[model samples]
Target: MADQEPIALLLLQKCAQVEAAAGLVTAVRALHGPSRTAPIVLLTEAEAKTDPKSSSVDAAIPIHCPADHAARELERWRPVSLEPTRRIAGILGPGPIAGMIERLGVRLEAAMGMLAQERIDQGEAHRLAGLCGTLGFAQAHAAWLDLSLGEATSLAEARRTTRLTLAAIARGL
Candidate 1:
C-alpha cells in the first residue's frame, strides 16, 4: 500500500495574545486538512490571563507544565492513533512545512516592510517565531525568540535580524 500521509498533532504551549494566537491560526490554516486532520492543542499555565480562544485550535488545554493537571492529561489523552499502514510524519514534514513557508512568504516580506515604516507589535514578532519553529528553522527560531522576547535592543534591529534569518530559512527550504 502507498504511504498514507502521517497524522499531525501540534501542542502549542504559550499562546497568550490574540495576534500571536492569530499567527498560529495562519500557520495551521496552511494545512487546509487532507487525508487526516492535524489537530492543534493549546496548553497554557495562565488560562485566565491567556483567554485560550483562537479559530485555529482544535482543543484548548489549560494546565501548568509539570503540574498534576498536565501530568494526568498527558497520561489519559493520546495525541494520535495510527493504522498499521500509516505513521506519523510530523507537522514539520517536507510537504506541509514547505507549503506553510510559502504561505508565510508574503506576510514575512510585508511585515519586514512595515517594520521599516513603523514599530512592529510583539504579536507580529512572536508570530514569526512560532512559524520558524513550525518550519524547523532552529537558527531563525532563536533569532526570533531573542527579538520577540526582548533580547534585541531595538525594533529596527529585530526587523533586520528577522529579514536575514527569513532569507536563510527560505534558502534552506
Candidate 2:
C-alpha cells in the first residue's frame, strides 16, 4: 500500500460508474497540469466497506453511488456542452459521436446486478440508480442516432427510452 505500484484500472463496476468517469476526466486534466499525480479507485458501496485497502490503489473515491447518482452531480461538471462531448468521445473512441454514451451503457449493464441485489445502502442505491438512468438515457439517444451500432429498436422507441431515462435521472437528482 505504501510503495508506488504500476496503475492498472480495476473496473470494480459496482455502482460508481459516474465517479469512474470523473476519475478519468480528473486524471486527464491532471496530466495537463504542472504538478499532478494520484491514483483513483472508483468504488461502489460494497467494495469500499468490504476492503478499504489496495496495494495498487492510492486512494478510494467512495462516490455515494449504487448507479447514476453522479449524473446529477455530473451536471455541475459537465463539459460545457460541446467541449465535454468532444472530450468524452476522445476517450471513448471513433465508434460514434456518442462513444461516451455507449461506454456509459456498458457501465450500466455491468452495475445492474449489483444494484438489483441491493448490495448497497439506500442513499448509494438511489445515487447509482440515477447514474443508471443517465447512462441508459445516453445509450438510448446514441443508439437511435446510429442503429448500425446496435441495441436500438426504432428512433421513436429510442426517444421514449431516453425521455424516461432522463426523467429517472432527474428524479434521483
Candidate 3:
C-alpha cells in the first residue's frame, strides 16, 4: 500500500465482502501494475483480540471517545455549521457535501458505539449535541438536547436515549 493510503476503517458489519474482494487482488494486479491496497480493514472486538493480523497494526485508536479525551488528543479541531456547509457545498458541488455527510455518519456511529460500551460519560451527550447542532441533524440534536438538559435522571436512561438516536441516524431518519 502507498504511504498515502488510509490505514483502516473498521466497520461494525461483517467484512466477508472485503475478504472476498481482497482475494481477487493478485488477479487484478497481473493486468494492471498493482491493485491499490484497500487500507480499510473491518474487525470486531472479538476479531481484534483473536486475529493475529491485527498485531501488525502500528496503532488501533478508537474513533469513539469522551469529549475531554477528544479535546486533549485530537488536533486542528473546529465545528462546521450546516447552513454554511450547505452554501459551500452548493458552490463546490455535491461531492464535498456527500463526504461531509459520510464523515458525520462515521462519527455518530463511533459515539453511539462508545456510549453503548460505557466508554464515555454523560458529558458526551453535550458533545454529541454540539456535533448534531453543527451538522443540522435534527433528530440526533433532540436526543442529545434531552440528555444534556438532564431529562434523563440516570446514566442508563441517557444511554437508552442515545441508543434510540443512534438507531434513528442509522436509519437515515
Candidate 4:
C-alpha cells in the first residue's frame, strides 16, 4: 500500500508566466504516482513546432492561462488522489531537487530483501545510477557506486537491485 495510485504526467507549455511554469512542473513531477503520468509540455510561443511523437510521455496538455490559470490546472490535479505527496509539494516552492539528490543519503534497506547478493548485473548498476542521476536521488542512488568500490562478491547483484530501486522510485514519480 505504499504506492497504489496511477502516475499523472503534466505539461507547462502554454503559460507565459515563467516562474509559475517551473513551479507547476516541479509540483506535478514531485507528486507520487497512481493518477496520471503526464509530463509538463511547456507550450511555449513556438508550440506549433513541438512534436508529440517523441518520448515516453502519456499525454501533453497546453495550459490556457498565460499567467494564472495554467498553474491552477496543476493544483486541480491535486486532491483528486487520496494519497497526497506532501514531501514533493514542499520542494517546488522553496527549491527543486531535480538535479541535487546526489548529496543525499541512500536508504537501501527496502531493496536488500528484494534481490539476493549474487543475482545482480553490473550493466544494470550503470543503468540504475543513470536513473538516480535523472531522479536527483543522489544519496539514495549512490549505493551502486559505493558497492562497486568494495569486495567483489555480488557486485552485479547489488547493481541490479539498485536499478530496481531506481525504477520503483521513478515509477513513484
- Judging by lDDT against the true structure, name the best candidate: 1
lDDT of 1 by residue, 1-173 (tens): 01134233456775458687667656654643331234455676655322222134444557655577666654433421222101112533567655766666656666656555545566777888787665554444665666677664545344434444444333433
Q: For each candidate, what TM-score against the reference? A: 0.39, 0.20, 0.34, 0.26
**Which model scores highest in TM-score?**
1
lDDT tens string, model 2, 38-143? 2233455533522222222222434665446555423322211233344544666546535444444444333333333333333433443344333334543443
Model 1 stretches with alpha carbons more than 4 Å out? 1-92, 150-157, 169-172
Q: What is the lDDT of residue 19 in candidate 1?
A: 81
lDDT of 3 by residue, 43-146 (tens): 33232321222222111224454556534422211212245446555777768656655666567656645544545445867777776666555546666667
lDDT of 4 by residue, 79-147 (tens): 212112225435562245432332221333223332333433455455555555445445324666554
Spell out the clash pairs found in candidate 2. Answer: 66-128, 67-128, 68-128, 68-130, 68-131, 68-132, 69-127, 69-131
Judged by lDDT relative to the true structure, which candidate is superior, 1 or 2? 1
Which one wins by lDDT: 3 or 4? Answer: 3
TM-score of 4: 0.26
User: Of the pair 1 and 3, which is ahead by lDDT?
Assistant: 1
RMSD of each: 16.4, 16.7, 14.8, 15.7
**Residue 62 lDDT in model 1?**
76
Which residue pairs collide in model 3, if any?
A: none
RMSD to native, candidate 1: 16.4
Candidate 2 segments exceeding 4 Å error: 1-97, 121-173
Better of 2 and 3 by lDDT: 3
TM-score of candidate 3 to 2 decimals: 0.34
